[model samples]
Target: MPLRVLSTLDAAKTQYYHFKAIIVAGMGIFTDAYDLFCIPPITRMLGHIYYKSNNSRIQPAAEAAMLVVALLGTVIGQLVFGWLGDHVGRRRVYGFSLMLMIAGSIGCGFSMGTTQARVLASLGFFRFLLGLGIGGDYPLSATIMSEFANKKKRGAFIAAVFSMQGIGILASSIVTMVVCRIFGRKDHSTNDADIAWRLILMLGVVPTALTYYWRMMMPETARYTALVELNVLQAARDMGRVLDVPLSQIAEVDLVPPSPPSYPLFSRKFFFLHGRDLLACSALWFLIDIVFYSSNLCQSHIFDIKDDGSAFDAAFKVAQFQAKVACYFTIPGYFAAVFLIDRVGRLRIQVVGFVLMAGLYFFCTYLYIKDSRGVPFVMYGMAFFFANCGPNTTTFIVPAELFPARFRSTCHGIAGAAGKLGAMIGAAGFFLISKGGDDPNRDEKKTGIEVILITLGGICVAGTAVTMLLTRETMGISLEDNEKEYEGESVQGKCFP
Candidate 1:
């Protein structure tokens, strides 16, 4: 029998807590974006302070280590924290990730060393810690939001949570610009701008720290308490407090589960039931991140703004350009996903995004092959728009909803880990391609960039095929219905109007 509390949660009107939940959960994402995207500028600052090179670019080896370490930590964090979320409870494990983020941010900012190698090692260590926290947030935040949201607007709520990413990126750029402007010296070679990078790195803690208290205060998701733990009374009480509803309405809920799964996670029965969905979510996420992170991480190099002034000035300009792109394309695409995800359906949106992204990648490839010197900001921006509105948002949302509450976080983490692995690949590949210098017109550099774009395009085509063939639409459907389908039971009715 379906629990009455679950029904009420799925049918509850938009409440104050819903918005509060979004803020608390969304801030984690905001911090995640800020920390991840803020690196380009910091690397520039590092090159200036430590590398002692005329061009002020860090060595290829140090740059790759710094860039890819967090990704590695994130992958491990996702798997570890994801399993913890299911085993220990979401609320129980959620605060720890935030704490790690706070520590990591501060540690990164305070990295101490007399030598360049030691400083790089210190920074890389802290960043890996930061990535762990950020990775944990992905599965926990998405799963919590999905469980709390009413079925009717679940897509919008989840998308809204992910949309904070755009805001975080904008914040990173703005903060970097402001810091560089204030601390930057007229002389391009001075160490005056050293503090600017530290400040930018540490400032990510504010949003993360702000949300930590509220994150702890959040009740364990009702689905986890009731469905996973089989504690209907606690679930009812938690939701009662959250939704501000009377306990009497849900305390009397039916306790019988209509054939809940008895299999362990990743067992044969579990795989048989959810294997295809897992494959789709993981594969699609992996594919999208390759395109997303590579382009995002290498934005400065791709734009190849001529060194018109001081190194500090160049850093500020890069920040401004990033902010402009975020404002024009990234932010809009995220909000568009928020508004249209439910209306258009996740499957169609993802498929369309992949197709469009493929076309744009091919076009960009052509432009690069033609040795176009001008920034293809229009094509690049359009790609960002579709990506945010399409796979990036949907990849996070679908994994949360498709699996049972028992394994939801674990599955989401696995998918997220897959995505991060792709990110590591993309970041590594593009950084290598651009490692030569800032000159986009360099013959060898142009060829490498064109090859990467073409590869991304081909991946998108594969993503489209995988998405269409394997994914399911969870729109306008209750979480319980997903469980019912897994149980091989006939769904009696839709829970949402």
Candidate 2:
């Protein structure tokens, strides 16, 4: 059988809109990382301000909720917005997610009440809403960017969008450092600390709000137009404008309209075709996030390996240290993935990342058990570096690439939702496990931390195995062809090839 001709989107040369889409979509991811991560440094600060006693740290349950609540919201948001992106249009529902984020961020900043319980509840509620917006961005941005990008550079483009996450992490640290420096020098009052946390949370609004207009202006993806909407002419025109190519160029191609699946997304037939792929995407993401969020949310505290000076000073020092590591090491890993994803291929990168992360975790565990200080810190940083350059990046990129366009956002949402579920467990479980640190039992606390580290290593090993068994390499394949090959039918007609 002859190969089916590619559509305008797949065949189009790389152009300006690709980069434009990257920035527009990338900023959303940037906001996500910033909002999600900025909380860790301030968790203690909130305790100081609201509880008004240095000894009164956030309760283990409340702290876990604070860390994981947004994840719950993200899971819901990903499902709702992902389906909306498919059923309505990607452009139509895109900006609303940011709007939700803006509101949630501001609400978090203003979170206040007569008692600590009220304040914690208020903050958690708003962060959950923010998570919803962040969740929506996952599927919408990945799907839109994937559809807009040419096959030749799709992996790099998608990974490039995700790399913004590294920048967001850096920004979270820098902003925290600057805020602490400004506030820490003057008055160490609870009120001052309160103001500082609010400032940090509210700062998330700037980048998200700035991108809203550009996000609204982005045209619907050509593939969504052609295949999902069955409007070949409009898809061609949209592609022509975005790619800066003549309509004649797009017009010359023989376009095939995608066949409406005979089965619904929940049908056995659909499951048979995509169930393995969905499981691969979801489970791999789940395993990756378990390690990713655990390290990320707890790093500042982990680096506080020794009992230090004043509580305020100690917290400030930890934030600054974490920020510097993120700036110097973590951010670089993201760009490395962006550079190597297309060149080295997604599966190889993910496999390498998981294996290296596991090895690094084991190394860190050994160092922790032996009371080796500086080296463990270095290994932890290296683990973070590999996480970004490996599974963290590929898990995101692969789901967008492997799914059928008709349900692309929905599938991506499911995978993203699975990841957030893992994040919730990692955040909440780590909080519970590490509660041993506060106990009079020093050995127990040490054992708890070591166990967490070893467990993360095991999770990474499991991730590597799942990737090996379940997923297919998607390097250099056009999105349409990838879907058609998987579905085993022509795009337009139902006839099996």
Candidate 3:
């Protein structure tokens, strides 16, 4: 028997609760982006504070540890919390992730040691904890928003939540600008820079902690309640209040046991039915993040801030340049995806993003080889724009929608982990390659940053093929109907559990 509450939730018109859920859910993502992106500039400031007396930048190994440890934490968090969300309940596990984030942020801000190595080690450990929290937010927020939204506007709603990431990135730049301006001084000194980085890192908790109570207060998603928990009556009542529907409209007699059992996550039956979808989602996410995270390092190269001034001036300049990119390109790209995702369809947008990014990367390599100045910056900026407007947003949204609710969180978490894996590769690989290319004594073609960009371009081309082959169009379809369609396909192909 079909659960009427699940159907009502899928068909309900957009309402105030929808926007409220977006803000509540989106704030977690906003904090995620800020906490992740804010570190790069802060790391630069850290080098000035702790390593300046040595007459060198932060050691490459230490810097890489600082940059990548959070991504590692995110991967673990996505898998652990994602499984927990399914077994215990989404609402129950949600608060734990947020709490971890708060603790980690505070810990990083206060990270201390007598020696520079000890301090870096302490910071890395706390950031790993922070990453765990950020990772948990990924599947929980995306799946929650997806399950709660109406099918008609579901893509847009989820995209809107993901778009908060743009604001978070912007906020990172703004916060850096404000902090650097406050600490700006005429002479070279580590004291002010040390205070500024700690304050900046600690401030990430403000918006995140503010949303904690509201996140805890949200009702369990009706889809999860009825379809997963088998609590039809409670689902009906909760959604009734949220959607402003009269309880009488959903007949009490219609409350019944969920029928047509779906295959469990990772089972043989699920493999036959959803293996392709799962593979596509994971691969696309992985491929896109390779380019996306790699591009993040391009800011320093693209903007090319001269190191002639005080470290404070350089931090301020980096923040200003990043802010300009966020304002002009990155943030706009996110909202553009939000506005058009429901209309243009997820698969199409992703293919477009990959194709455009591949072309842009190739163009960037060409520009770099030509020794061109003043133009590669725009090329790199456009690459960022399309990544957000296309694959980055769509990859997050697709996994949440394409899987059955039983396996939704798990599958989304897996795909998200794959993306972060790609991010780790991108961050580490780009760093190594860029380091080699910048060596005054090295001239190998293989070690050049241009080669890395071209390799990324090639990866994007492969992503386009993989996306088209693996993923199905999910636009404008209810979650239940999507589940049913998969079952029908499996049956017609004579696949059985």
Candidate 4:
């Protein structure tokens, strides 16, 4: 076989454009998390306004739909945009997703009707549109950042981009808390409560709008240019411009392209080559998101709310509590992953994180069994901390690193879509499992929250085992090297060696 040639992108030193790419990509994630998590607080307030007779709470089905609908949109978006990113070019379709997000956010804010059902229908539809945009952002941002970063810092860079999710979550909580404080009245039936949710929804538009021009300004990734399109000169020029190096310097470098894959994405050869990788990436993401989205969107349900409090007061308290947890624990875990991912390696961190989270979950389950609220809450916070620090962050970074450049975004989207499916399951199932019956007010059975915690713990344990069996460490290795490694392994055996 001929030797693989490294392009300017594979060999180029990290530069200003790398960090710039992170910021541009990271901002999109910030908007995604902000928009998604903001709904939980609003849901509480919505219950009060729309269903005043039922203790100011909307039906459990409506609540689940509000969270799951976006995830459904996300799964669809990941598949569609992931394909489009590869079929067209990343930059060509990148800005369109942001525009969708802007439109969706505005639409969600304006959702109104004569009846609660119509209003919720409008809101769920708009949020689904918003989720489509957010889903598109996942593969695009991960692919863009991974392609831009040097191998030495690639894991950290991707992790940093995802870590913005922590910031987004924190921002959502903070915004909700502040909005509630300003607009919340003792009587949730008033117009002020209605305005607050709208304002919070609209707030997502600001960061997304700010990032649009910059996203448009970014050139197509050099890997996509040279390898996928076979436009070596253009790739070099774009790389030079982005790296702020002279075009002559890039031109002087040896930019031999690697041999293209011999089979199509769905062919038997392709499956043999990458099936294990796809499964590992998809399964891990699926498990992590089951807990991640469930915990995030169901915060009000998990925490103890005082029966004596008014609806507005309960909503404000929940928002405040969530903000504190995110700010203090969740956000910190993301940065911890950012700091350690490159140094410690992806698999190790993921394994350790899963193990830690499993332990925490089991402990929290025990606490729940004992009917102990305060300690379990702290343990839950700790679980979130380790999750972001470990698998939640690593699952995203690993898939972007593992795939071939041509199919990278598509594969990442598949994995991400799997995660969203899990999110949908978790979002819907959490309500069913936690409530222990169809009746929302049913007393907790032995199989209630305790069972949910135990299941999550089991998922973490299984995730840890799968990581050991299927995932390879990609730290300090160029994307090209990683691809070559897999290609070599495929040639040696029918499955990944």
Candidate 5:
């Protein structure tokens, strides 16, 4: 590597070191976690407000109605916003999603009915709109932040942003507990619960507004601007502006056009290439979402009955407690993954994550022994241990690194959509599986998530294998320098970790 280039690259990174990208990215994730985790509380509050005294209706049916509607909306969000993230810039997409969030929260706040059927029917349409915004967030926030961050510390930043999953869960639990403690401490007044829950739903607007601020401050991706023009040099110049360096600073000394485009993702030698790697990324992402969304959304059932005086009320509190605890594990796990990815290398960390998740799944088999309503907390702690620290972090980091500059945003959109597909399947699977069976509450606790975890573990392993074969290393090099290494190439001072 050239001396000035090496030091300048380090300096460019250092200049932005304390600049607050971490906080912005973390908050983005916090909003996501808050949006999704509040479901259990919302359901409990809804039932208490509108249907508890009826005593003849099933809470499970009410819960299922809300979940399926929200999940379907989320799937739609993923596809629509994901394409927008590629076609539109990430900053702009945040505003569009925020509008959806604001509208949904407003709809949910006003919903009221004296009957279960009225309650479910009203909240269903409201929450579906909310899910659309939540779905839009995954690709837009994750993709933009990944593109803007410095490479050496990129893993940590991305993982840190994702760690908001835990924080959001924790924040929602704290809010739910506070609401319960103040109001429900005396009596289960339907009117009180109704007002309290509606207030919480309205609070979602706080994040929607803040998301606008966070996104507005961020620069449109330098790489993205350059690519749309279809000029590598202009792309470098755009990146140079963001990095606050001159165009002369980052461009290759011997610049010619980027390599000729290859048509297929899978080709001769019968292994991974850019296309195959992207395929693997898309497929695996879709698979993981299947497990993650289902488990997260089904918290009320997974934690099972508390057997306290009010089954629905007590179950909601306990489920929040368990989810809060799961957050504790993931927070530290994210930092650990960030520290290790560049040092140990991306593929190794991802494989280790997959292996760890596989081991966690095995333990779930025993945890789900007959008639024993297991503590799903520890099982998820293990999964989070691997996920935040492993594939969850690396899988997101790798796609931006692996694809050629020419296809980066397009490929990211495709892979992100693929991951969304997995999330949709997992969410839908949980919905359908819960929809089936005479006793969904009992059955989901018994067999629902245990089966899904094993399936996610298997898909993660396959995705990891694709990286090892087709992907080249991306550690400690500039994007331009790394692209050189990808085409049977080498660059001075540019070495893979």
Candidate 6:
């Protein structure tokens, strides 16, 4: 019928605006991708200068520190930025996080002697700052994008944005290979060491500024306007414009029920509604971070097939460094999501991903137990597949859809901080296990590498279990209801607490 045709047309046009808004919000996710992925190369560069030996505890510390510090910084960033975003506006916090990323990146590049206490202190401060920015991106981008996207498509859109972390991390690897080639690993002096890191740090500014550029070109979300600006008529007008609906369909009345402009994150009312959801979501994130960081932070180790003393030497050397950089997949993953996301649902993809990842981790665990390289590589490859499919990509998408605008960022921040705490646990977990068991170094009751992989495998399995029990299917639904469910109350329909 003509009516059906018209309805379809209207839906398509509305989607165009949703697409644009999702694109804008997803840019911040791109930064997260870069931060996680890029740090590896910088750490590798540190190996060339400071650690000089890839196997040194210092190298592991630097790599783990890269994630741990960033994770720690994110804890602060999430709490600070999330509160500000909800209080001020997502756009404002988005910009604020970008600035911090730029400053942190540049500061990291300028790090002084790891030998010097002052330099180490400086490194910690700025790396933490960068983490803060990276951390801030999750809630801001996910919430803003989810609000703008159609409910049917929100999960996919959120998944797409979060998937950018893989892309950003991958791109860092690419850049590392190129940059290291240009500035080979061995000038040997502290000055030379600092130079490469500085260059990498400076590059962080480019994305930081570029995010703002795109935001300025876009308008604040109609949803944000509806909720925060208290203008239903204007919100409707904006919505109508984006959806291409007749002005009449978007009546002059406010769409969201009227309520107080401000609310606290921890108010009893909010907690009762959202507490369980937050706990489950946060725990899930913690599990993901444990495996995600443990694997990615030790990317170089994944390629090692032999325990032969000479093989590790070959890998640890500057020559094989290119291979290490190749491990980054965040960049390519992010770009690919730009296309695949609009077409798929987040939960579906995530479930698929986790299933595949469970298999891969299990395989990796087996190989470690068997003392064979084949299964490790196989699992590594499978993880690459899973990165595209689910856990790595889709977990980040959930909070964006489930939380109401009022608590969206807050819930996201809490989840993210929890994940960062997981990252800290993961980062430390690897080094601790890698420490020679029984014998402080060299001799071991078990291979440190196997211990780490098995642990990650166990974590991945735990995620699979929790996700099945705690994860709700978020396929097609009215996005407006997500906000309405809370209808000015935190728990009205939330999965929290």
Top candidate when judged by lDDT against the true structure: 1
Candidate 2 ranges beyond 4 A from true positions: 1-6, 54-56, 252-258, 305-315, 372-375, 485-497
What would the TM-scores of all predictions be?
0.95, 0.93, 0.94, 0.93, 0.79, 0.82
Per-residue alpha-carbon lDDT of candidate 5 for residues 358-390, written as tens digits (9 for 90 to 100): 777666656665427564677767677777777
For candidate 3, write residues 125-243 as lDDT tens digits. 99999999999999999999999998889999999999999898889889998988777843566777877888888898899899899999898988888778888788878877777
Q: Give the winner by TM-score: 2 or 3.
A: 3
Clashes of each: 0, 1, 0, 1, 8, 27
Whole-model Cα lDDT of every candidate shown, in order: 0.86, 0.81, 0.81, 0.82, 0.61, 0.61
Q: Residues 218-299, candidate 1: write the lDDT tens digits.
A: 9999999888888788888888887967889877544664345577889987878788889988999999999899888777
Best candidate according to TM-score: 1
Per-residue CA lDDT of candidate 6, range 1-497, in tens? 11121122224434566666666666667666666656654554454445544342244554566667778888888877877777787876687787777777777777766374466567877888888887787788877777666544555667666665554555555555555555555544556545656675567457547657777655556666666666555665655665666767546433435575344667775566566667767888888888777666655545442222222232224223334333433334444544554466554555566666777776776776677443444447557656555666556767665666667777888888888788889877876676412234543524676677667767777777777666654555444444443535322222211
Cα RMSD (angstroms) for every candidate in the order listed = 2.7, 3.5, 3.1, 2.9, 5.0, 5.3
TM-score of 6: 0.82
Model with the higher lDDT, candidate 4 or 5:
4
Candidate 1: deviation at residue 415, Å?
0.4
Q: What is the lDDT of residue 52 in candidate 5?
A: 54
